[model samples]
Target: MTGREFLEPDSPQQRLYLDGLKRIEIMQKILNELPKADQNLCYQGSYFLAANASLCGLAANHFFRNILHVRKAAIVSALPMAVIPFLSTAAVYDVFVREPLFSGQLNCEVCAVVRGGLVGAVVGGLYPVFLALPLTASLAARYSSSPLPGKENLLRFWLSVSQPVFRKMSWAVLVQVLTGLYLATKHHGIYVKILQQMNTSRDPEELKA
Candidate 1:
């Protein structure tokens, strides 16, 4: 399925997916309690995710030991159980980006994830404004009522319930991973076929060589 279809609320597998969100949180907690074992886990997964590109997992181990000092990066790194889809952008960040803050004082900008440079620009400029509209409207509607005290309580309720927070991050990662895997498989096959055809192309200068 396309990213849109896979992400659709109406999909048959939506419940299974929403359930996975809860699992992601549980895994993060487990990984924190067992870092040594979890480091091994991260190495295997990170290697796969990076497509065996380099020895990053080894570098991470050395950094964790003494050469560099970081007790943590984020649940994605620290937690063996943390599924990729569940991790926020913070979790996905490498040594360069700051690690996840357990303090729960997330600034909105920190949570935002962009595809690449151009997409990042779009996300930075437009997403906040788009999210702000409903939040403001809800606050305004509640505050404009006759009873001001009731309005304040209502505002609190809205903020508590409506904030996207971690769930949105999970959705974005899921969308990326699911679609990426599908297209990667399909395109890999396509590229191989094209290569084969080119090697055996009829129009080639076969007689000259």
Candidate 2:
């Protein structure tokens, strides 16, 4: 009954057309419910979500489920949850941090950029474990293909590196020592500066001191 079915001449094409049309219809309905008075942000967010769905949805089975060997059921719900944190953080920076704290000051501007970038990287690195893996597995099982890449493969790779005596816990202790020293000498100062700017009642003009 969708426009795709009506437009397609062949049976296989008809199914593709109808299914796509139905999804589009549903998305349009949801988008239309957004208030027209301030729709720019809503539209941008909707578009980002729609694009994520297309990339991480059933259509992406070959890349994620088949070749990558991910669980079949996880794709349907993964993208929105994974993307939301990053998108929300970006929005927060744009609307809040940029306007209130930055004010064209060179150091504050640099720190704001660094903080947002670091937050984004941390979110991106953790998203697969926190959000994507669970959602698609739960919501889109029928669309997903199964038999995820077992942790055994990853374990094997780790073992290969860890068998060497140099790869043992000694490296960790050394790195920790170096990190502590670096933080004590440099990172601590930077942290204090950031904290003072964020918390102190000192007027912004006095900050240069």
Candidate 3:
């Protein structure tokens, strides 16, 4: 069935299938038709996102162990650290890469910079609320920093929440903006190499298609 036709169906199953198909369509276009320069940025953005998330997660985990004196099983702590930042990265990446490139606005230097700055501001502003809060709360609770008798929970909450955000927010936003500029400006040397690797690595039959 045509993807468009699939989308018109009211059945939940049809909707789910349509969603998957839409994602596949989008990915194929991105991988195949996007300019080498933009494609490179996407690859770098993904790598940068992973690296940034790892750093933030590690720092948060370190705080729990060193400052709070709470140690968690390696896997238990590592999973959330990996998952949370990647989630935020997905949105930032969309703003930095997909939104501009897909809309054809990224070809112009001024538009790209404007879009990047605006998106970075938004992503940075929300870092504390979205990224920091849950991470802080989780780490704080993991260390069992519950309120003591005669002490308000508010104080503990404020301290845990503020510290991480204050330490990371500016850095994170700067990374986001720099990423946008890099993707928009950097040479496609790495991107070309990555595509060549993918092409060489694909199965013969798949590559033929």
Candidate 4:
């Protein structure tokens, strides 16, 4: 068969390409439905969702399947996929919707919280790749020096035990989300009070004073 056959509709390559297109469409729909904000960057907002889904899916497929070993693995597989999107949505909300309300430097409460959340999401997404580099090097060195048997079994064992590794990182990410929510609420209350004062003031000069 020639290489061009792979592009045929029934071929695996074509199906993969179509799947990618579908995902992009879905991502676009998500972006469109979000609250429009002056500070929201389309690439950054969409990428946060994409990264969360990819990373969490990786963790679920590699680690959770081995750890759970349940009959309903298919159903359990959907959990990570579903949960990560919501987390990403919250991150996007902070950066796009909440942060823009402050319209100030990073020191401002709303700005600080949202920026912190954005930083945390980026770092969390890259963390797995950072860890994998050293582990990959070690594995390559070991395999090159002395090839070992039952590598597949060893991999399965590692996957089964690796839940804790990601769990610790997840806690840090969770803290960033919580911090943003808390600060936004606190600062928004103060902003409301300021608005109320301005509205109630009898004279514009007195309000400014």
Candidate 5:
């Protein structure tokens, strides 16, 4: 029998199914009304990327100036160095992965989270590399008048600076991965519920078939 024939008009299941359908319709309408550029930006996860990058920047700044006893002036000078790589990474991920996933062009939630995690790892890994640049520059500037004993010495110096930064930023990477996974799983659950509602609201014959 049809959903209306089988389910009482005032039943909770009927209400839930109707509500789910209405929400889906409203979501479609909202998406359709959005400007193309804004839609693209949202689908591409620009907001997520920007927020993550900002947090990472704040964490790095805190580590450098407070924990590591580095100068604020030095951190300010290296801000561009830290920011550019993240922006580039976010742009690439947005174009290739996030847009497709969020636009409903790609339906695999697991794949989306995997891609997000990879992006997060890349960003996390770069933290130390970029963080080292300013420190290395500062060191080189301090000894600019004297020739280094060897290029190996500079390499060692850079490593010394990077290792600690990497250690500190690892936690941020973990948090990013866990957050992405949790969001993906939550969205998947919502999607499954909507599908269940649609199925339950269909004609019994159609459901059986």
Candidate 6:
């Protein structure tokens, strides 16, 4: 039978064909409501995030063991200080830079770079402070007669301890921003191709044929 003739209501496969069409329609509706970039860009962005985060973690481990003369056993515990910032930075880049760029909201290369840099700087600056909290608290407990320092003193101490972490993570942040910018540019053309392919695949005429 011809393609359209096979879809006749009296045919044995009619119910299955209709069900498949309904499922496709539902999927198309969902895709229409969501951002186009979410199709492929999100996966690409996640891969970039995960790979960079892993690299940053390894680098941090090395830095702690070699540069800071930290014990190998202790270096493992301190990895969050190195890895968290990159993860957070990557998250920010995916949300602010990748989505917008691929979605066509962000068209300028300079804009993407600036946004990525800003995201890196902000996350890099703040994440270390939070990551250092446990270390700072442990240090305070170990070194001081008091279990906890006063709020002002604790704040000051946290900053001091976190400074080194921040410095190391600054390099990670820079790398992440550069990587984000590079990927954004690289995927721009790819994004268009993906959308075209998806559209062609979902064409009702093609499905009917």
Tell me, by lDDT, which candidate is best: 6
C-alpha lDDT values of all predictions: 0.33, 0.38, 0.52, 0.46, 0.55, 0.56
* Residues 77-183, model 6: lDDT tens digits: 55665567567766777788776755555667777667755664455444444555554355345545234447878787556555676677677767766665566
Assess every candidate by TM-score: 0.24, 0.30, 0.51, 0.31, 0.53, 0.48
Clash pairs, candidate 5, are none
Q: Which is the better candidate, 1 or 3, if ranked by TM-score?
A: 3
Question: In candidate 2, what are the lDDT values of residues 124-169, reduced to their tens digit?
Answer: 2232223433443433345545433357685664344233422232
- Please report how far candidate 6 places residue 141 from its true position, in Å: 3.4
- lDDT ranking of the models: 6, 5, 3, 4, 2, 1
lDDT of 1 by residue, 40-112 (tens): 4433332233321112222222222221222333333323222221232122322211112111122223232
lDDT of 6 at 150: 75
| Lowest lDDT 10-residue stretch of candidate 6 | 63-72
**Candidate 5, superposed: residue stretches over 4 Å from native:** 1-46, 61-75, 81-86, 102-104, 124-149, 183-209
Per-residue lDDT tens digits for candidate 4, residues 1-209, read 78786777688888877765553444334334444551244324434444554454455344433343323434444454545544655455556544454332223555545654564454334343234323433433444532323676776655534546567447545644554345454445433444454456566344223
Whole-model alpha-carbon lDDT for candidate 6: 0.56
Off by over 4 Å in 2: 1-63, 67-75, 78-87, 102-107, 124-130, 139-144, 148-209
What's the residue-level lDDT of 7 in candidate 4?
71
Tens digits of per-residue lDDT for model 3, 51-82: 56555555555554444444555566666666
- Number of the candidate with higher lDDT, 1 or 3: 3
Which candidate, 2 or 5, has the higher TM-score? 5
Per-candidate RMSD, Å: 20.6, 21.7, 9.2, 18.1, 12.9, 10.8
